[model samples]
Target chain A: MARERKFSLNEVFQHTKQLLLEHGYEGFTFGLLAERLGVSRTAIYKHFENKEEVITAYMVDEMEQVFAKFVHIHDYPTFDEQFRFLLNLILYHDDLHRMIAIGRRIPDTTPAVRANKERLEQFHERMYEELNQLVERGKQEGRIKPHLPNRIVLAYIFQSVVVPHFPGISLDQWAESIKEIIMYGVMTGN
Target chain B: MARERKFSLNEVFQHTKQLLLEHGYEGFTFGLLAERLGVSRTAIYKHFENKEEVITAYMVDEMEQVFAKFVHIHDYPTFDEQFRFLLNLILYHDDLHRMIAIGRRIPDTTPAVRANKERLEQFHERMYEELNQLVERGKQEGRIKPHLPNRIVLAYIFQSVVVPHFPGISLDQWAESIKEIIMYGVMTGN
Candidate 1:
C-alpha cells in the first residue's frame, strides 16, 4: 500500500529540491530527508527508489523549468531584449550550471547518460536555432550586427561565460557588460 | 628498500596520469594502478600514501610545466603571440578538463577538498595575477582591449575553457574554435 503520509509527491519533491540546493547531491541522505519532512525513510523509498533517482528527478525538473523560460523568451520585445535574455540565460542561471555539471561529471560509458545526452543535445540545438533566429531578426531590424555569422557568435558567447560559477552577478549586469564588449565589436544600435 | 622495478619513476607516473585521465578519481584503483605499472601494490604505497597524493603530485608537476612556459613568453615579441602562448599553457597542453571535473565533483563540505581548495585558490590567484599583467601589457601594446577588466575576462575564460572535464575532450585541436572566439573577444583592435 502507498504510505498514507501527510505529504504529497510534489511537496516531497519541492522539499527535496530545497535540500539539494542547501546541501549538495551527497548530503541529501534518505534519513535527513525523512527527518526534515517529518516522515520515515521508507516514505522516501515509496516515492523514489534511491538518492540517485531523487537527484535525477530534481535536476531534470529544474532543466524543464529553465527550458520553459527559453520557450517563452520571444514574448520580450526587441532583439536587444532577447539578446540580453540569451547571454543571461547562459551565464547566471543555476539550471544551466547544474545541467552542464551533470553532463560533464556523469560517466558517458553508461547507457543511461548516453541516452540522456540525446535529449540534452536536442534541447541545446533547438535553443541555438532560436537564438540564431533572434540575432538574425535583430540584424534585419538594425538592432544587432549583420556581418557576424549566426552560429559562430552564438557558440562564442555560449562558450565564453555559459557555465558561470559567480552566483551574485545578475543577468542584466553581465549582459550589459558583455554587450559593451560585443557592442565595440558588433553593431547593435542602441 | 625501494622496489627494483623494471620501469622508471617517470614510467610509473605516466601510467598513473593516464589511468586518472581515462578512469577519473573514482574509477582509479590502487590495484589497477599497480597492475598497469607492473609493480606490487605495496610498491605503489611506498611512492604515494594514497591515490590523492599521486593526483596532487601530478597537478604540481603539470603546473610547473605551464610555469616554465610563462618564463619564456617574453620571447614571443608580440602580445598576440604571447596570448597564444598563454592560451596554449592554460588550455592546450594540459589535461585540464579532468582537473575541472575532479574539482567540481568534490563538494566543499568534504574535509580533504576543503583543504585542497585553499592551495588551489592560491595557485589560481597567482595565475590570475600573472594573466592580468599579460593582458595589461597587451593593452599597452595595442594587442588587447583596455575597456574590459582582466579579472572578469581572464577569470571567465580560464573557468570556462582552460579548465577541463575528466575523460572528456583532451585534444588541443578541440579548443581551436574556442581559442578563435576568445582571441576575437579580447583583441584590442576588434
Candidate 2:
C-alpha cells in the first residue's frame, strides 16, 4: 500500500480552488481530487461527505479571505484609493469571479450547500455595506457623482473587474483603461 | 414504425440554442436534443456530425442575427440612442452572454469548430468596427469624452450588458442606472 500523506484544511482548500478553476464545477470530482492530492479517495471522504460539501467549505474559506480585505478598507484615507484597492483585489483574484459563476450553477440540495449559501449571502451583504460607505464618502468628497444611486455606483464598480480583455491590449493597459472609465465618464468636457 | 417529423435547418438551430441555454454545453447532447425535438437521434445526425457542429452552426446563425442588428445603426439619429438600442438588445438576449461563456469552454477539435470560431471572430470585428464608429461620432459631437481611447469606450459599453442585476431592483431601474453611470459616470463634477 502507498503511504498516506497528511493534509491540512488549507491544503484541501488550495487544491479545491485549483481544481475548480481548472475544470469548473461540472468536471470536479473526488476521484480526480484524490489523485491530484496523492491520496486515497477515502482520505477525501474523511474530510467531506460529497462534492457539494467540499465546494461549500472551499467557498466559505475563500469568502472569509475576501471579507478580510473588505475589513481593511478603513485603513485607506481617500475614496479613490479605497476604490482602487477594491478593483485591484477583484482583478487579481480572477478565480473568485469564476467561482461565483460556478457557485450560481450549483444546486442547493444538501444542508451544507444551503448553509454555505447563507454564509455567502452574508458576505455579500457585508461587502455591499462597505461599498455603500465608500460610495457615500465619494459623494461627500465630490469624487463620485451625487446624482447616481448608491446601488448603481456599486454595480458599476463591481462590474469593472469583469470587463473582457481585448486581444491586443496588455494586462496593465487593460487595468488602467478600466479604472479611468469607471472614475470618469467617457463623455467629453461639459 | 412511427412517421418521422420533418424539421428545417432553422428549426434545428432554434432548438439547439434552447438546449445550450437550458443545459449548458456540457449537458447538451444529441440524445437529449433529439428527444426534446420529438425526433430520432439519426434525424439530428443527418443535420450535424456531432454536438460541436450543431453548436457552431447555432452560433453562426445567432451571430448573423446580431450582425443584422448592427447593420441598422445608421437608422438611429444619435449615438446615445444607438448605444441604448445595442445595450437593450444584449440585456434582453441573456442567452447570448451565457452562450458566449459556454462557447469559450468548448474545445476546438474539428474543421467546423475552427470555421465557426473564425466566423465568430469576423462578427466580433464587425461589431467592434461599428462600436468604434459610434464612439468617434460621440466624441466629435461632444457626447463622449475626447481623451478616452476607443477600445476603452468599447469595453465599457460591452461590459455594461453583463453588470450584475441588483436584488429587488426592477429591470428598467437596472438599465437606467447603468446607462447613467456609463454616460455621466459616478463622479459628481466634471
Candidate 3:
C-alpha cells in the first residue's frame, strides 16, 4: 500500500501561523517549528524555502485581508454601524504586540513595509468616499447634520479610533465617546 | 600642556539628534553616527553603552519638551492658540516614525514586545492629561459647548488624528482636517 500523506499544506500553514502568533519572529525559528510540527525541517522545506518565506507569506495574506476589509468596510448599513466597526479596530485592534510583530516582519517604511503602504493608504479613499456618501445620505434623510462635511466628519471618526490617541481605554469606551461627540455636534445648532 | 579633548560627549549626543531627525531611524546607524563625529566606534563606546541607550535618551528628552509645552499649552490665552499647539504635534509632529519604533521596535512578538506595548500605551496618557485639563477649562469658561463631556472631546480629538478612518491622504492632511472638526465642534453655534 502507498504511504498516506500526513497533514495537508493548509494545515501546515495554519500551524505555522499559530507558532508565529505565539512565538513572534524569534520564536518561529526553523528548528523550533519542525520540532513543534513533529516533522523534519526538510518537510517544512518541501512547503517553504525558509522561515522568512513562510512568515512573509503569512504576512502578505494578512495584508491582503486588511486591504479587503478596507474595501468592504462600507457595506455596513449605516454611518453609526460604520463608526462601530472603526471603534472595534481602534481601541482593541489586534493584540497590539502581535500586530506590532507583524509590522516589524515587514521591510522598509516607505514601500509597503513588506507588503504595500500605497495600497493601504488608498484604502482610506474608499472609507472617505463612503463616509461622505453616508453623511450626504444622512442629511437627506434628516439623520445627520446638514452642515457637517462628510469628508472631515469621516476623517475625525476614523483617526480617533485607529491610532493611539487616547491611552488606557477600551474600544467600547472609544466608540461611545466618538458617537457622543458627533451626536452633540450635529444636534442643537439652531 | 595636556592635549585638548577632541569633542565633548554632550556635543556628540546633540549632533546625533540632528542626524536622527534628518536621516530617520532606518538610516540612523551607529557607523554613520560615528563617522559624523569623526571618531572610532571604541571612542563612542567610551561615552555610551550602545545605540539603544543613545536613542532612549534622545527620545525621552524629546518627550520632556513635549510635556513641558503641554503644561504651557493652555497658557496660550485662547482656544485657537491652544488648539494650535495641539495641532502642532498632530500635523507637524516630526519623529513619529522614531516614536513608533521606540514603542514598537521588538522584531518578534514576545515579552519584550509586551513591555514595549506598555511603554507606548503609557505615552498616550501623557498627552491625554493635557487635553483633559484644556477641555475642563473650555467647558467651565463656556467656550467649549456644555453638551459634550470633556473626556469625550479629549478622546475624539485624539483618536481621530492617529489611525484616520479614511485612506488616500497624508497623515498631516488628515490631521489638519480633523483639527478643523475639533474647532467646529466648539464654535459658537452657527
RMSD (CA, Å), each prediction: 5.8, 3.5, 7.3
Displacement of residue A60 (Cα, Å) in model 3 is: 3.6
Residues A91-142, candidate 1: write the lDDT tens digits: 6564455445544444444454455565666776787678778767866776
Instruction: List iRMS for all predictions.
Output: 7.2, 2.1, 6.5
Tens-digit lDDT string for candidate 2 (B1-190): 8665587788888889988766667668899888877889988877677889889889989989877876787788877788778777767665676677667777777788889988887887878787888888888888887766788777777777767776778888888777767776676664
TM-score of chain B of 3: 0.56
Q: Candidate 1, residues B75-110: lDDT per residue as tens digits?
A: 887777878777776665556644755645544544
Model 2: per-residue lDDT, tens digit, A1-190? 8655587788889889998877667678999888877889888887687898889889989989988876787788877788888878877665676677677777777888889988988898888887888888888888877767788777677767767777778888877777767776676546
TM-score of 2: 0.84
Q: Which candidate's TM-score is highest? A: 2
Model 3 lDDT, residue A81, Cα: 71
Listed in order, each prediction's TM-score against the native is 0.70, 0.84, 0.58
Query: Which regions of candidate 1 deviate over 4 angstroms?
Result: A1-42, A104-122, A132-153, A162-175, A179-190, B6-32, B35-42, B97-123, B141-143, B160-176, B186-190
Query: Stretches of candidate 3 above 4 Å error?
Result: A1-46, A50-52, A63-158, A163-170, A179-190, B1-29, B35-38, B78-80, B94-131, B142-176, B184-190
Per-candidate interface DockQ score:
0.18, 0.58, 0.23
Candidate 1, residue B137: lDDT = 84
lDDT of each: 0.62, 0.78, 0.57
Better of 1 and 2 by DockQ: 2
TM-score: model 1, chain A: 0.60
